[model samples]
Target: MSDDRRTTVPVWTLATADVKAPGLPAGESMTGERLAELRGVLAVMADEPIVTLEAHPLPDRIDRGRGIPLDAASPLAQHLSQFITQSARTSLTAARATASGECLYRMVVPAKVAAQLGQGTVRSMVSKAGAGGVLSPLVGPSGKIAAHASYVPVGRAAAVGTVGGAGATAGAAAAGGTALTVAAPLVLMAVAVGVSAYADQQRRQAIEHITELLEQLQEDKLDDERSALNGCRAAIDKATAILLDQGRLGVSLGLDSAVHTIDTALSKVEIRLGRWRSALDGIPEDAAVELATLTKAFPGIDDQGGAFRVHLELAALAVALKRRVVVLQAVEHAQSDPGNPFENFTRQLKRDQQWLDELELGVAAVLVRLSAVKLARPSGLRPVFTPSEVDRLMNAAHRIHQLGVGVTVDGRPTDVAIEIARDKDGSVTVFPALPA
Candidate 1:
């Protein structure tokens, strides 16, 4: 798909039990059908690993108020037990659940991976994972799926297990064989650990990708600005060439000030571009947290990655303004005695003036947007452009404004006005105005 047309997918956190409940509930059992469905989902998501977290009830504690603990030696119970460390099991259980009664499983999917899967598929996966099952009807038909702008992992695990092996172990555990009970937890742990590692790798890759995108955007913007500056220089040269060609007539009109103002503005823009490049170079490599901040702050970063294209446009308008002033001067110099002296030149001057007015407004709007741009910084968010850079841009805009004001038909003949007429054929004609 084209970059502009691509869909955005958010990082999602999925839960197999009621996420809003006061205490974690003993999650629904992963039946054969559910297991098969989940494996299918995982198979589709093989490109990206999903992190899983299991919170199970304590073996020793049983609270009737919350729910009953599962049989300690049950396959599910044994799988939960593996997560409990000898040193912190009690504290972890007490903090995570009520009376240590229920088990809760959570899976976190990164944005890239989630992009490949549909919401219906996710709902089905969650449902099969045991949300809204017979044992937990209150949880609702669909699993809890929370979207995040950033990836957040539950915890890290160590070990790796194949997809086929993990499924087989889960199936074996569900079938209730004593021999398989001992092996199930080990296989599940390996799968959990492998997924955690995979998720970590994905996170690192995401951070790198975001960093590269940001840097490339800055580079592209700078290149465009440089091109715009070159365009301005070319427009200024054209205007200068016109004045030189007009010889004494141009000199008499006193248009040197307008040219100088535009030249100064071009210089300021050039300096700002240099500073912008340096600032972009100074930016450090992004960490995961900073990447999250940038992603949230600049969700449409790609869309914003280009020159404003206003500088060159304004420069063109300035050139047109100078041209109009020269034409007015030439008409006066000729001392023409036409019925409607210099009518076409006056009409063209009006059009150029209107264009200049519109371009000035555009520059003002660009300044407003530039003032609002903020980038991620170590000390917190800061304006992307430095105060000096912004001032330079403003100065350039002011010069463009001044060029419009400086070049004008201050001494043009009053009778140089034009008249417009429209025919039935829908064509319009311009002619020198008759008296009154």
Candidate 2:
């Protein structure tokens, strides 16, 4: 609102008509990238370089008026609006943040600055080595902030402007930089020496701790999860055994009892695992990070091992259950449909039910893991995941692969093109969005 009243101090919009941003969110319409493109176009048309606001006190929220895209709407429209509004509010807060004593500040300069710099129309703000701050750009009557202006903290205005003037060229920079290069190697050498001295000591301590934990897991609590996992495997074995056994109804009843017994054991394991869910959350970020290198590589995805582990266990159970369906279908298909056809049909019905149950459980597990991955983790910490986490995901991925499901979308633009749904025939339908 304060920005609205300043007729002489108007902020520029991105000012591009055909801004091409596929795969970018609508809320990012006035983002710095788009703004830069705007400045380039404006400069080409106006026959002069655009200007940036060098003399910024703080930008209270820049109130770019809002309107929806001409072609589309999405389920996240409300959320997108909320985020854009929040960004405006946040920018405003950042603009005036110094007054509030907020220590951290970020300033996104207007796009015009880039256009000027790209075209060599203006010189950049220079900084003297060891200077405390930077200089602000000068404002001109042309309604542009300054030709070669830059964003600097309100505190750094003096140091940056005076640091290196027109006389300081790349040649001068070379003459002044030997100390920094030498200093960096020396610092690195010292760090290496320190790490070498401490590396063995840390290793010994960790080895001792891990040894103790292994002993405990093997003895005291004995992680019934080991048993649970075994039980799940045993259940699959029993289910497969009975279905494959060349036994009549009377003979198979004993095998069916074994299946029920295995199921009970697996259920106990599931309940036991539920108690350990919180411990997964307690896994140190450092530890989870170490483990993530083994799972997958993606960006901005959170350390999901905590939730993903549970999903893995459930997925394993579902997979084990699903394997029984394959055996059932094989056995039922082996039987002739004409002779005792009703009995054969009943077997098929039972197999279908088992398949559906497994499919539902598996899908739910995958979705849960997907949700976990969606949570906030330290961004770009490392691309590699830890071996254990990777092993877990690989196992889950293997099950999903066996199921052979994938994301799909269909529909006209006038109808819902992207929707998430599950079909009874054991496939997931995902209607993903595409740029218009």
Candidate 3:
């Protein structure tokens, strides 16, 4: 019966169905989408509003030799439909979980409410609660589940009416009197009941199909998010180890007051650099800029002369450096090309990881100073922490480093590192060779 007929599926944004079929008016077929969407209208008319949902193959529209349309519906759809009865609306469990770590409140009170709920419905109840952000912005790098499950509400109805008609005009019958009229009405009633039951089943099945679709979209979005999170954590780990090896964090945070104290010292250095620039401006030189750099990038750096390019190379090594620190080291390229030596193709993404080790200590120090995550330094402050005190400071570093030996510093692996001796006074030295 659906042969050569175009099947139209409406989109979500539209409240009214606009399905256009030629035999009917432009909006006439819309009734099929929502004769108050057929589900609602039927519920209202029938004393019992039973609906059964089932998943079945879509009727394929086969092409004849001519137009895209005008072909028979797919035989598969018809076959599947014939097999299914009113078994589509079976209930599923209410409990659900979202893998994405997205929260439950967001769904309970969705971020955006659509037109299906009228303006009055908003005023009716939900409007009293104010809106809020979906995900907690404070959620750290750790993974946690944050979603809640939900279910759909539905109504049920009863199946009534005789298998066939009971009454008929007996006087107008054939030679057998009541027989001819009696049989005709009975057949009509049989057809009506069967058609009614089938239509009800179809409506229920369609709703269930929609629900499954919504769940799938949510799962796919979660998968993409989880993958991105793993990438970030990997990047952090790689960069942090490189910085730790170069001692950037140590140089940066080795002196408690010294680290925070650098800001005022840095400002003074900048002022002196300006004075030197003015003095050099009048003198002509082959490389005034390089000469000037030698005089004043900063007192810690400039007066202690070194190359900027060298700084860049050291920066690469101190990948675990949570902040900038001065150091010198040689870099060997595994595969050398004409490309920049400071940048390795494999290690580009992990650059910022070095910064965490540096700032974390600084932050902890400030917090202990200001009372934050945790930190402890000597009450007695001088030029810097005494050497003995600094050695004891390593205790604050993870009791067990996350690197755990599989990590490398300058191609030296540390899957297993042993402590040869400890200066019982207060120092621990680990000698990790190429670990097996």
**Clashing residue pair totals per candidate (backbone < 3 A):** 2, 23, 23
List model 3 lDDT by residue over 71-120, tens digit each.
01222112112111111222111111111111111101110111111111
Clash-forming residue pairs, model 1 = 26-102, 26-103
Off by over 4 Å in 3: 1-98, 102-260, 284-436
lDDT over C-alpha atoms for residue 154 of model 1: 21
* Candidate 1 ranges with C-alpha deviation above 4 Å: 1-221, 228-239, 242-344, 369-436
TM agreement with the true structure for every prediction: 0.19, 0.24, 0.14
Taken over the whole model, the C-alpha lDDT of each candidate is: 0.30, 0.28, 0.22
**Per-residue accuracy of model 2 over 346-436 as CA lDDT, tens digit each:** 3444444443343434344433433333222335669876887666555544442332232111211110011112122222211111110
| Candidates 2 and 3 compared by lDDT, better number | 2
Give me the candidate number with maximum TM-score: 2
lDDT of 1 by residue, 1-436 (tens): 1122211111111221111211111222343244334434543443223223323221222222222122344332343343332212323322343223333233233332222211111111122355433212213223221111111212111222221221212111112211111122222222222222222222233334333444545555444433433343334334333422222333443345545554454455445345443433344434212223332332322132223233333333333333334333433332232222223223333443444334434434433333333332334356475887556445444432333332222212111111122222222221211111
Q: Rank the candidates by TM-score, best first.
A: 2, 1, 3
Indicate the TM-score of model 2: 0.24
* lDDT, model 2, position 92: 47
lDDT of residue 86 for candidate 1:
20
